[model samples]
Target chain A: MSTTRLARTGGPRPAAAAGRGRSLWRTVRASGWSYAYLAPFVVLTAAFVVYPIFASLGYTFYDWDGIGEPSDFVGLANFKQVATDGYFWRALGNSALYTLVLVPVQLVLALVLALVLNNPRLRGSTFYRALYFLPAITSIAIVGIVLKLMLANFGDAVSKPFLKLGLTDEPLQFLGSPHLSMWTVIAIGIWNTLGYNMIYFLAGLQTIPKDQYEAAQIDGAGRFAQFVHVTIPGLRNVGLVIVFLAIVGSLQVFDLVMVLTGGGPFYSSDVITTYIYREAFGQVGTGVAVEPHIGLASAASFLFGLLLLVVTSGQMLAIRRLRARKEGK
Target chain B: MTELKGARARRGLTHLVLLAIGFAYVYPFLWAVGSSLKTKIDFLDGGLGLLPSRPVWENYAQAWREASFGTYFVNTLVISVTTVAFTLLFTAMAGYALARHTFPGKKIILGVILATYLLPHGYTIVPIYDLINSLGLLNTLTSVILAQVGGGLVFGTFMFMAYFSTLPRELEEAARVDGAGFNTLFFRVMLPVSKPMMATLGLFTFISSWNNFFLPLVFTLGRPELRTVGVGLYAFTNQTTTDWTLLCAGAVISLAPIVVVFVVAQRYIVEAIAGAVKA
Candidate 1:
């Protein structure tokens, strides 16, 4: 079967090379066009994407203000500072909180919406899907800005009706109060990206064959039982991927927080990205002026990246183990 | 008859629920556009009402002039277009090569690409900033465009590679039978045939570059005149004092182009995203 597959694919096979050197040279010559084609991408990625990662690692060791060369070589001090800093911890905790709240809530909401819109019998499913997804395509920064303005201007507008209905006597400060800011940001974050997850869930729903539902019905399964037995199990793989993507995306929340509150009423909504941005480029939109600390920011960034790596790999391993145990059963 | 009526009622409820949620989802944008056209006093007093007593068309013009949005709009266009063009060309060539040819170091390249993709680089801007500074391209549109293009190439290349791999081998053979050389075949046949993929990638790139705030903000820190609409709007809020109508107008202006793009290409964009997640 493998040989037939290879034959069908039809690629140039080595003609029993007498020596490795000659075949290597022949292969290189044959791939000239490939090298030519790959040159630009290789050059650009190496320069911009890959090199910056290593360069930032190097920057983490020094106390640089992003002005001149790194004459002040403070070894591990930046990392130590990042490790011990209160604001860094706050930012890290905020990011974790954001992800912890966002992923499950957003995923559940998305799945429910997907199920609703996935019904072929439902009229105007396409229109509903598009309507839900419209915000996902718009810039998050714009969304944050518009929401900030609306909340500021329309705070009374929203509160008046609620107050009259006796929902609450007091108006809410969405971005002002320290207690409310992070939750408010989380709510907006969910709204902003919910559509992407909804679309993913919709696609996953399509992949689960209709025959499974029919089979469940034949077994006297109710709607809820069929969902539990067929839908959940069928969506397991795609569900894992969606969860991973959502968590990763949430952990890097910068634009919205930066624009909305600038991580403030006093570091309440500061996620790791906003923390890094503030350190690297001082605090913008705030009246206070602070110096840019590139080294500390780099350290903070690398630390967060390391944490993400561990979390993601652990998730992957858990997934593998679960899959293996199921197969074993 | 009663059972059928019950089913009909259930469907109506579903639509009702969906319509309500959908309205809430889209209400903020609708409010922004409405507020943009409202007089300042009306905006303040209208509270939840979407219509203005009289439309304030001057708000958009004032936003365009006062915020320097015209310049920022032009800069954003140039940067997004250049970045998308370069990204498409470079990624297509590399993707086609990777898909079609067997070469030494291919595994290494693929491995590096995968590793980079997995590792989050949200904070790598520090070094990238330093690198661009050293190149004497700091505060220039070129810096922003280059960074955007470079950062996107990995994902674009990966996408194009998958797309190219799915194309039938018979097409390449046919081109070769017609005495087409590598360059001729790719430029004339392969690239043209790949228009749909290009559109998908191009639309994605355009939306991202158009909406991007951080890179443009950081790169153009020294030159406020060089800000994109996103950065410019942010600055407008900071510089001006509670010009709520103008700010709303500015936000709407910045958002209009991208919304139009999304509306026009909604089908392709949705499919592309869905396809990407599944893949």
Candidate 2:
């Protein structure tokens, strides 16, 4: 029935290549096991991960509820609305405010902890290391829900202390107050991630070579001076990677935000991810759930994803250039 | 003598700070463990204490039965193990090929694999799921395992390829010269040499597959029978007025395997990560 069989019986089916047919089959037979190993990865990735990007991007250009063939081309309409939309700006503002406050404070806290733990003479070093790294392996959904409960359960833990110290007259509802939700989200991230980042810092610390630290000490360098002159400079690339990663991770912040705030306390904590999810996955609230806005959500997703990719890639390039210039590469 | 005195003062301050941080870090874990033993009233009784007066170790068993997590645990283990197994097989073979073989189009294929690593996992979710569903794999362990394999391979391939690039090719060539062929050289010779790297990759992949949340969440349809520990653990806390004891119990059971892995494999982890960094 097939050309290959016909060719075998009738002298190459047209005299093109009688010998090549068997060679190709033979080649396949030999590497069949390799293909067996590779099939799962390739099939899953090509179908699930790679295809979604193209599909979602295509969805951005069409108005389809994902249940019908009556798709309408709403060219760039979602993008236009998202750009001009007040809610979009507010969402961006919340993320920016969160990051601005969170990153520096978290970094300082982690760095201080790292410097303290870098003491070679410390007892229970391994136990302390494991403790610090604990939160990192927990699932985001669990962390999100647990942190929310803790905040709610012990509102006085944060609010009463701040208020008792005269920081504010009113107790802040960290997750309930629109003003405080984003900061609390940031705090959750820092708690979960500090150890992972600290490990990165520790690795960078190793590259400094203990001899340099000894030399600095011999030259009458204070601990602060050694850190300022040697440790900080030594950590530049790792810092760059950490900063870039944190920025990217911040942009992709969705699961925790969804579980904890649901982009709420008045839609004040909504970012692109939660906004996209709500649009695409029917936000249920206040006695009614809306239908999916597949087209609009897809458009917004593309814009957000593209912006994130560009920012992260740019940061990576800048870091490489800085590294090269310093290394005289 | 002045230097010694200053060093002593700084060391004392460092020790104090380290001790404080160590307390903060360890306290939450202790609280989680302690609270899991408390009754609902006991949990509501106080903010945080070292241990409960009445330890209800049965909460772990009760939570297990309530969620029917016994079934889900087996499902997760199967999917995770399958994923790690496949990822190691394919990524290593492909990595070995890319790193050692001077084949045509090798650079282009390797480049493509590297590029895929930069794209966020979320980007491909729709297409991949659609394909799986089209193939009648929706809600199947195979589908989840497949997704994990893909996600893990990108990193696994990169790490292994980087590792193989550092290995000596002469040994392999000598085997090849002896008419050993590709399969024999790869399996009989090259693989035996990279046992440590493979073990490291296995540990990394196993932990990642165990901790995977998003893939299971998206694919498993919240079917209590199909969820991984990462997704299933949220059942306790997704509701308002979460029972802290039950929640902590679930968290403990969920994290146990990973903690054990971390504790047992610390030496290999440190070595692998340290090697990865320097390379």
Candidate 3:
């Protein structure tokens, strides 16, 4: 609807409306009003959004701490350093691992939950849905911090329960151990985000015609077969939305890590954003201290941004191609 | 008859699994709320327990007073309210204009807006931080509000455009025939008709700005007084790592408003989130 309106409004001027000179003046006057209406959006986007993107790119080329103007023009040095930086690569790899694991797991969990809750005969679905989604609305920083406290050394709440259940003899350093920290972060991530995805899938599922299932049932399809044929196909668009968002969101994971581990256990849990933050803002007490490298941070962010764009676009294209092929078949 | 019995069995099992998962999902917040009411020693003892032995309500007061959560709450309110207000105003204006009229460079502007939606703020945050510093707005609520509103505008505009496009053109045409100007047409005609969409976007923006951590953490790094609840809780826990009772209390305090708002406006929230998939 909006695009059609946009096209209608933006279409070529009617040929017989007026003389050329007067029509040009009318067009100019109309544009003036439109620009007047859009001035705040334009100015704010230019100042805040557009400027920052180009500025960050420009900052990547020069050696300047975040405080001052760039005096030393070190061409590609920041890029070169980032190229060889193990921590930067590690951060990217960790983010990749997170996106890889979290997206599909979150989607499956969300789909299952959505399907279960979508049943018309289910009792207390509203309460259960609200309960499950409570964490989705809370501050992630607070959740991460509270979770860390709950899961603290052996006598802590989470650890005590695990020990009592005979899951382990000692406290599991979920956020403390390097190996477990990232996965713990991923788990908390999935837990917090699962409901949001569930909502998406539920919305998608609600749009499917109920008679499709009725048709399948009449054709002797079992529940599982109906789910596979009717429900999964119905959810494709919603699944794509979740996948795209999950990829973008996972790449930008910072708040949880900042509060939970601060990329601790020797930078083992660092995502690109945390790594960039420490590089730009300087983290202390984390055992991986480097002088605040604003230039390199900017470079790393820019490079990562490019990589994310490429990955996202590539995935979108792949989805498109697959859909096209499916339609063709 | 056996098939009917099997269906009943399946339904019972489904409820069992749902209830169990719901408990696991909600236990953390419940634990935090329960722990917040405990003294330090009691907290450690009953940390995982749903009920506190002695509910020390004063823990809330302690967190409120000592942690300066009052200031953080005010700061967050100021930031979220201002950000949401500006986001609604600017995006609505932009959306109405883009929807109702065409101008030179409209395509370019729309393309840029769409691109901004895809571009994560994390990548450009360094320069944004620098930009705020250069403007002398660092460590101020204004800086965070400005950035939040700015970051929120594109999506808000997108939402507004989608809604405004669907609105009947006859209303605007009638207003124009009555000799109403652009301001009257928009402020009087369009704004009144667009309340539902506005509410959805306003809640969306408010919740996000309220929960925003990373930007405020950057902007208010030096000024603790300017910290929002998210950043304040972060700073609080960092300083008082051993005070689980107080920290948990602070967490509950910060989470309380959100929970209440969420419960009250869950329909709107769910609708907005679900609608986001379409956008």
Best by lDDT: 1
lDDT of 3 by residue, B1-279 (tens): 999999999999999988888888888888888888887778656647778887899988988888788888889889989998999999999999888777657889999987887665548888788878888998888999888887777888888888898988788878877888878988999999999988988888888888898889899989888888888888776663557788888888888888888999988898878877854
TM-score against native, each model: 0.95, 0.87, 0.94
Candidate 3 lDDT score relative to the true structure: 0.84
**For this target, which candidate reaches the highest TM-score against the unseen true structure?**
1
Which segments of candidate 1 are over 4 A away from where they belong? A1-23, A161-169, A322-329
DockQ of every candidate structure = 0.59, 0.28, 0.60
- Kindly list the per-residue Cα lDDT of model 1 for residues A213-256, writing each as its tens digit: 99999999999999999999988878888888898899988889
Q: Which stretches of candidate 2 lie over 4 Å from their true place?
A: A1-43, A68-70, A169-171, A214-222, A284-288, A327-329, B1-13, B119-122, B177-179, B240-242, B270-279
For candidate 2, give the DockQ.
Answer: 0.28
Which model is ahead, 2 or 3, in terms of DockQ? 3
Candidate 1 lDDT (Cα, 0 to 1): 0.88
Candidate 1 residue B61 C-alpha distance from true site, Å: 1.9
What are the candidates' C-alpha RMSDs? 3.0, 6.0, 3.0
Please state the Cα-based DockQ of model 1 relative to the true two-chain complex. Answer: 0.59
Worst 10 residues of 3 chain B by lDDT: B235-244
Candidate structures ordered by TM-score, highest first = 1, 3, 2
